[model samples]
Target: MASSMLKSAGEIQNLIFSQNQKLTHLARCGRIDEAVKLFESMPARNAVSWNCMISGLAKNGRVADARHLFDRMASKNLISWNTMIAGYSHNNRVLEASQLFDEMPKRDSYSWTLMISCYSRNGELERARWLFDSMPGVKTPVCYNAMIAGYAKNGMFQDAIVLLTEMPVSARNMVSWNSVLAGYTQNQEMVQGLKFFGEMQEKDVVSWNLMVEGFLQVGDLESAWSFFRATPCPNVASWVTMLNGFSKSGNIDEARRLFDEMPERNLVAWNAMISGYVQFLQIEEAYRLFGEMSERNSVTWTTMINGYIRIGKLEKARELLDSMPFKNVVAQTAMLTGYVQCMRMEEAVELFEKISTKDDFCWNAMISGYAHCGRMDKAVELYKRMPTKSLFSLNTIIAGHAQQGEMHKALEVFKQMRERNTVTWNSIISGLTQNGFYCDSIKHFVLLRNEGRKPDPCTYACGLAACAYLAALQVGKQLHLLLVKSGHVNDLFAGNALINMYARCGRISSAKQAFDEMASVDLISWNTLITGYALNGFGRETISLFKEMEVNGFRPDDITFVGVLSACSHAGLIDEGLKYFDSMSRDHSVERVAEHYACVVDLLGRAGRLEEAYKLVTEMPIKVNAGVWGALLGACRMHGNPDIAKFAAEKLFVIEPQKTSNYVLLSNVHADARRWEDVDRVRSLLKEIGIQKQPGCSWIDIKKKVCSFVSDDPMQPGATEVGFVLEMLCAHIRNTEIMPWSSLLDCG
Candidate 1:
């Protein structure tokens, strides 16, 4: 054919057709420059020729050059204008695209679509909506699909659903239906998403894939598998979603079986399996799968690197990272994040500097690393230098400040944040509670509710802790009801928090009821219940529960021992206290900390064994903290042993020099022993140091109002009537011969 064509000039004209075809091929392959050279070298050009070259240039992101070539065209068509507008929109030059959209001489449905897609992709929903509503002629389904997709992508599930429902039957297609379903799933409304899926008239492969993914997102593996089995021709996405779901749900065996049985596997499928093994800390399985991968992408290498990092094999992670053929930003970010998680901030920072192109995630990793390491100054310094800040960065900085007890700085960062998430509210509330600002924590919790940020288990746990510490029973019960209504009571963490609140409020029965109602109980649940019982002076019940804990295959932890020892000490069960204290390391393998020693010392002191308590404090292998000596001093006061009281008080002053309670307890001990001279000496020492004792106070919640009474409190409303009633109660108690009322009458 080439020989015959060479023999005739007419046949040689076929070179024009061949050359145009070459130009189209180059443009399609994203070689726009080559296409331009070919187009320029063409001996002649036609309208189809110019349109092909212009489309190639615009699609390849050469918008400016595409526009220049478009202007050079002697005659322009609607396709030319649409190409230019779409080029600008796709490149994120929305203003240029909008200007071109307004300037188009004759617009088609495709022309409107180009503009709508631009606004939708850019999250300019209002502009997209206006364009949709003001479309010059009848709207196309593609136009509606683009707008619905944008709403779904932006997490506006309700808006997307409204538009889907309002759409004409002619315009509602599979893509539109899938977009709404995906929107619900993305927003975590899995139940609604599933319901919508059930109502779909027709389901395609994409629809089935979305259903599988939606069920996986909600941790409903049985439903996810049901969809997976129903899929007519499962694509790579279908298999990968199920694999990932199984892995996340801790069904690693099922994930592996599906991975091995997949008819065809993509890079993402391989990564999902590797990630699943890593998530469960099955490093050996992950390693085997990594070696077996027929082909590997950057994700495969990075996944293994992260797997090693998660298992504390940082050296292995570094080795794999160094061996990577192409270290992309994602791989680098994974390693940086691994180092940050391991508390290796110095190494993370070193790697961060080595990254040639730093993304927001890289900067966030460095900031979060410094924050976790307790270097807030460095975190703030790096945060200020970030060229652009995301909500994640802002949240990390806020959490960093909260961790350091800098509530002011945390609040400042929070106020600066353009967006606040559940984590942001959690950080503030939890920080306030941890730093002993219970009322402030509760106040922020209310603000969180008012702001419409739904509280998760962590938020409710923090709020409940504040209630427990503040003894805000009314507020605590309200939150408890919220938990019950929200079904958060089924969560072990929230249930434990409920027990803690009830116990701290002296409602031991309520605490026990919560403990009994839990469907599943962890060691924390057992410890919380035990601690609550001990706090409310149910010593025998506390001991009985501890026995039950051991029988239930739950080993005692440090907190458990603290509660048990306190129960024994308060109830004068000296022998039981000694046995548990000695058995801490032997029976439970929990090494005794300072609090444990303090409990035992207090136990002995409260049992009238002053000499034994002092000897134990002096001879303990661990350092005697002020708490241990403080216990001994209080015991000396109880038993009227001024000599030992003086010794313990001296140790207390040195250990905690400014502790006013040390001096006061010593003075009280001397007064109990009728040693006026020693009491005077202690009082003079307190005056010399300019120390003042904080007055003890009590509070009661009456009709949801907390009324506080301090020593010698100023007369409040109805004080005279309350005093008269109290006097009558004291007289009745005295008349009734109640033994404990004598001390109360003497105080009145």
Candidate 2:
């Protein structure tokens, strides 16, 4: 190249930029060999020539070659530096990018922003923030947008919003608007996201895409489609975003329609459609798409396997996994979780052992599987034996412990964690409340505040559940006030929790107020309030509320059925209960579970139709668990029919002979038949085996401290007062149809 550059001006066979342009075209076309041949023929080379070659090399992933070419350049200008920096940044060479940035002859705002963006792309968020603070105030929108996008990507929505607020609107650009809109979407503030989006009249492609993405983020598929229709032109991104929103919104038919109509399909578009089917539990559609894809990447394969796993089509997931030409941690974890979640623990462990490498996500995925499947021991064992720990892994195992009623162990892990974030705290609190450590969870909630940490919605949700568990209206009110003061009253988790707490504590009006005041309600919010209404014997109100939820465009899930079916049973609406069961499958596409069938049995049994209840249980597709059989048996006992009661009891006993309720229910059936000999035999068998019921317990939280009391235990702080309160409540309920037994447990 230098030898050719020694030619005289008259000997120059080509114009300077003409030759450079040809070289750029060659490089851009990835004809590196021919580009080099042309480069060597150049009579002269300048900074632009070197930058072009550098960019080509970097773009082609020849970062070392690009670096060598950069170093060998005789003179470098600002363009040269920017070009090289962009190449390294694009190639993900963050350290080299930072080195180049530090050594640049002159640094402008683009230089600063580009470097910051490099860090952000690499997920070095703290490093990006450091660069952001060091930027000079000629600070362009690019720089702030980079910082905002960085924050948003890392889930620091508040930080992103705060910076967006402090920055002047005059400095706003499309990138800036996109970042803020995306930040709001990621934080689940779809309304505000749209507000910011609609406010952007001077929009570009990214601007329009951001708004569509915001609607998609909140499962507002109709709104997203409306926007997509209104757009003058839609890009691959817009089409895919709309399709994905539809898919996730449980409109797989709409998703397929959009996918089929796409004019041009990129890999992203392909992945989105595949992922959309999986999200909707349309496993056949997802797998069909996966098979139809002529060119499938890791994402497509991973999506198909995950969809199959979620739908309990583990065989299909394994087949896809085995057939995949490319396998990664995501696929491996998906398979492992499939087995673990389905309670095939041995198979999951066998697969896990065969994997050579496991990332933090892999560990967490496995832990999550075990936790969800109720194999807490295995989950705990794996967590202890994990070679590495991440915040995700720790939080997952902590949540698993909480799920399994291992509050003490969960707290131990929380206390031992090197890094404790909000999720960790939330998991611990949730576990405590879920495991019946209500007082302890409430104490931890106060302790969290005392430690200068503000509770997120999940935290308040757990605390509110604790209050409900304890039936503490006073404590619930205080937490409510605290939530209002903290300005998180609109949070779905907090609102739902407050509703449950107030309803359970006999403050139904307050609960309704909290529920009505909520700006946005999720499925859980509706379920909580509906269930509260049912528990309060407001069956008509429960049904009406459920109807309203659907009218407002919310889909009812399994939990919703529990409330509605329970309402039906309590109100003797046998016909209504059966209608809901049919609708659950026919209209809502919700599969009827044994619990649902059990609710139907309870409804029939309460109406004194033991034969109908028995027929329904026998016709159930899945195994009727003890709960279902027990309901039928209880109905038999109520009707004083020993034959049917014995039948239901035998089924329940085979499932769990050791369950005290099964024995107690059998005894009651026999006693109702005047089978005194059988009742005595049952009493002797229980005493001989030393099988005793676990005592009922209650606890309270006072000023961030836990105090516990059992029905017969006297070690609690306010044992005497608790005993007195229980006796008084018992006396008050003595004249009611139901008997009061301090030690008796309610299955609900």
Candidate 3:
């Protein structure tokens, strides 16, 4: 019996030895599941075998399985307990890790440090600090480093600095210094980061890399280059950072130079260069780079798609998107965003539907596209169908409703928001102003400030525009003061709005002052100031501003030329107007739309060159609209040319038959020519069409409230007194030697 037992024991020992070897090999090779299976099938197990299996499962992120095996173990050593605790820590199950740690019969430095790292990784810095303070044994440098890094990562600069200063002399390390410096750099405090870096006793490669990244963040290529040259040995990240800095600064040439100079190019470096080309609108160059890449990722594919979309090459974007090996939400959304940008709402919707897993961004894009195309009803419908609603989704719905002048609907959406943001407030304020509820727009802006939501640039711009439309100069100035106090007066958007408001209020000097004070000027700034001058009848200032704009390296856009031509026409600069109109397509490459043609025709017709105006209209390349004919008819009235009036009136009857001005202008032209029969016929036609000329009215601002007056108006509060005063003034003028014209007297 003893001999049989000995033989079985020998066989079992051999089997156990072979299985242990196989399990170790599988775990090392990262075949963790196979290792676990091998472990489960074993008939006999030792302490080493159980520890190996538990460690393998924990290392492979199967923490639950590791814990199950641990609980089932009849006996466990300190290593087994530590392994289970570390597994929970690594998996971010901090509570379970802490519980296991408390129950441990013995504790190690590694066990405590793992728990600290776990808390830090999860952004629970306070909990991490408590564990560090209560640790029974000596604190490890690694544990201190983890806590400091967590503070820096969370932007707790003061707390991180406090810890760094209070740490034991031995705990101070390169990682501790780097974490704080990186915190400043990450927070966009590059200047402060530089000051801190200057005081560092010893700097490593990571320190140098961070300084380079900091300079690059602010687009300071010169500073970045100086730092790059100072780097002991630049890594791929350093090279990519420099490349990206140049790309964003619009220096494509410099970016390419850096790309070619890289000793070893990786996927990231290639992507940075490709994205640079995409940003600069060099689409063909981006495509070439994309094709040259040996490896491509999801970002690369999406970037190429975005490049095509920028240049209106939808076909190319579609082709590449279809051929992509994998399609993620980002790639799909890129195509969807392109459709929205191009105002192809239906196509955007179709693409949106094809995305099987639609996220909030995808839904927002479709909703915004519908709103942009003035399909608010469709936008609202899509908003309802959204399975989930984020703040952005709700804001989109409110903006769409606001954009279409549905104030009540916009308000309804605004009230529905459980957590209202500044964007929501801006949408309602801007919407009210756009829909001609200027007073309401300003009122909401005031309410926004009172509600503890400080206004952003959009809010200021919209409010200023409301003031401008209402000609409430006092209110505009008050908002301007608020903008100044807020330190956003120099922002391009707010500055542009200020200029527009001043200009629309006939305060040309104030508009020019705003324009002059701008630290940086964009196309909108120049256009706003010039348009303001033209609007207030400062024709010479508009022309002078245009010249200054050209001299200052500013190119005129379509709107700029519109302002220029309108100014020339208003000032009766016929030759100048014609010269600019001709040069629009030739010199500026600005194609003349119908509006420009109208300006040129008004100029010639107003200058008594009816024949020239008529010839220009007849020879215009584009289809002539009602404005062109209306100009000719107005000129006929001034010159008493009945022949041209009939021609213009006939076209107006077809193009804009319901327009009251066309009928009025034609009747005046016939009256000037003493063509009574034609006048009667035109007046009868107006009556048959049921077109009544709306009474001309003017508004005056009285202590912020607008008081309106119409010709022959009896709606004035003190009409009888006003009539008596007006009669006395007219009688006094007539009593003097200077007598009024017979036609003017009869009309009065």
Candidate 4:
């Protein structure tokens, strides 16, 4: 009988039109009215019947029609409500989703999970958690996974962990594990995530894929490659992970080769390739890949737009934004970032205002953009006006104040942070440390310790730097103990800072110990170690380390070069240092900046090649400053060459004529030549011009207190002792008939 009915072509056509698949096809092909007509003719509607109709209405944004169908369904089940709720939520109808949730007669796990997902998708994690907690009935792993993934996606990893702990043992499935592991991996906590994987007895491909991805995300490409080789059955995901890692790390050819060799390419695989191009700043390649995408999604558009923004191609970003067939928050965000990055703050602000529903990220982008553009006050204002704030928003604002030298504002923000993280404390400490407020930094380090907040490497580095600046040996020693206790002595930054502090405080042995303890070192690490050795006259070690840096594949930068050159200058390795300076541009690709030139001049001057050094100074690429000329003049004084000394002093005077040092240097050069009339004439000119010689002063920081000393100062606290020492020294010298050596000849 069924075959006979199918043989009737008209009846078969009618039955086909009534099928759910037929209606869905009609809607998918944009025949909404036909879909609705077909849905209306269904005599016995099932979940599919309602889903088809609801999807059609949702597709066309016919909210009232969807809601009408939802409420009128006498046999509506969990899928029906979930579909309607998700449709409403996705269409930016959160209030309707909420009301439907409130009015539903029966709520299942799917119902609660869907609502929570809606909140999470909209950046309302708090509401998502609220809905998650209020869910009735025994929860499924899907419900737990959805909420946990939401937290993880939102960068609330600690909260995600907390939620994971609350799930029943039965619900602690592989899906739940993947969420937290992926979150940790994204946050650069690979070790913690790997531990979770090890504890999972049922190790599946998903777990392995996530583990590999975690390594890849944090720039540990070598480790990820090792894992990929060890995997029993690697999927396309693993391949894509390697491709992304290589491309992001600046291996585009490798990424392209892997991409071409892929067995199959899904949308994700394609996006990875496009995104790789973006990461390498190869915008043209990204566009080429984008153009090759026969079909495109929001992710593809967003990636292309973001690439344009990153490369300072704002017009391209806007054109892409304008050409989009549909626009989402991600696309808008890319456009906003383009404007922000280009310092088009007004454009960013205008776009931000146009976003009717701003999320935490939207606010973060604007505030961070303002901060980056030096509009700190505007950043703070926008940050304050955000209805909801995240750690990112706060951090960006704090960094702005810190960078602008507004330490007080940074401190205030740190104090007011409701949930202070390691970065928050580090920022405030760094600000105080950088602004010559070492005492305050130390005080906060102690306060942070008392508050049970463990310091990270950055905190230790900043603290050690502060200690070096203040010569706080005791404080640095305590920090060293903390480093040992915390098992962070192997950290390169802390180790480097320790070497600096010990060297500055005259504990060269301790500095060497710290250097020896370092397990890994970079150029800055080598620079610090060498600078310490050089300043303490351990010239052999300094030169040895400079050689070691080259052998270790650490190409020296200007700072490293300067440190090595200074050591050479001090140790009389003038010829070797000059060779290094000459080789900087040819061998290391380092441009000969002013500091490098100054170091060369010092090296030559120290070697008593006064004429050659003076010629080098004249031919320098940059204008010679007073310091460089002053150094040359001082060297000439030692060599008893008053003619060159006078010429250098005059050059210095022309640079800053009002500086009394120039007058003093020139007059002394004349006095050295027995030109007393010239000295008298210079003195009279200074008196006539009302140019007073500023007193030379120095200060010592004692017990967290500052005490200043001036040359021949009469009002110092130690004046009595200083006066007595001078008289006794003079009397002893006269009694012994000491005579001047005239090494610094007054006449040439």
Candidate 2: residue pairs that collide:
none
Tens-digit per-residue lDDT, 119-155, candidate 3? 8877788888898888877787887888888788777
TM-score of each: 0.75, 0.63, 0.70, 0.68
Q: Please, what is the whole-model Cα lDDT of each candidate in the order they appear?
A: 0.84, 0.80, 0.84, 0.79
Number of the predicted model whose TM-score against the real structure is largest: 1
lDDT of 3: 0.84
Clashing pairs in 4: 672-746
lDDT value, residue 283 of candidate 2: 77
The candidate with the higher TM-score, 2 or 4, is: 4
Tens digits of per-residue lDDT for model 4, 327-391: 65667887898888778888988888987546667888999898897899889899889775678
Which ranking of candidates, highest TM-score first? 1, 3, 4, 2
lDDT of 4 at 354: 86
For model 4 the TM-score comes to 0.68
Per-residue lDDT tens digits of candidate 1, residues 1-748?
7876454655446766788789888776545556777899887777668888877776765666778888899888887788778777867778889998888888999988888889998888999999889998888899999999889877788888899988899889999998888877765567888888889898888999988888777667898899999999999999998998888888999999999899999888988988998899999988998998887876788889888988889989999989976566677888999899888877888899998656667889899999998999999899899875656788888889888889899988777777688988898889899989998888887778778566888888998999899887767777887788765677788899999999998888988899899877899999999998888888899999999999999989999999999999888889999999999999789988878888888898888887888788888888888778788888888888999889988988888879887888898888888899999999999889888787777779999999876766556666677678979999897677332222311222
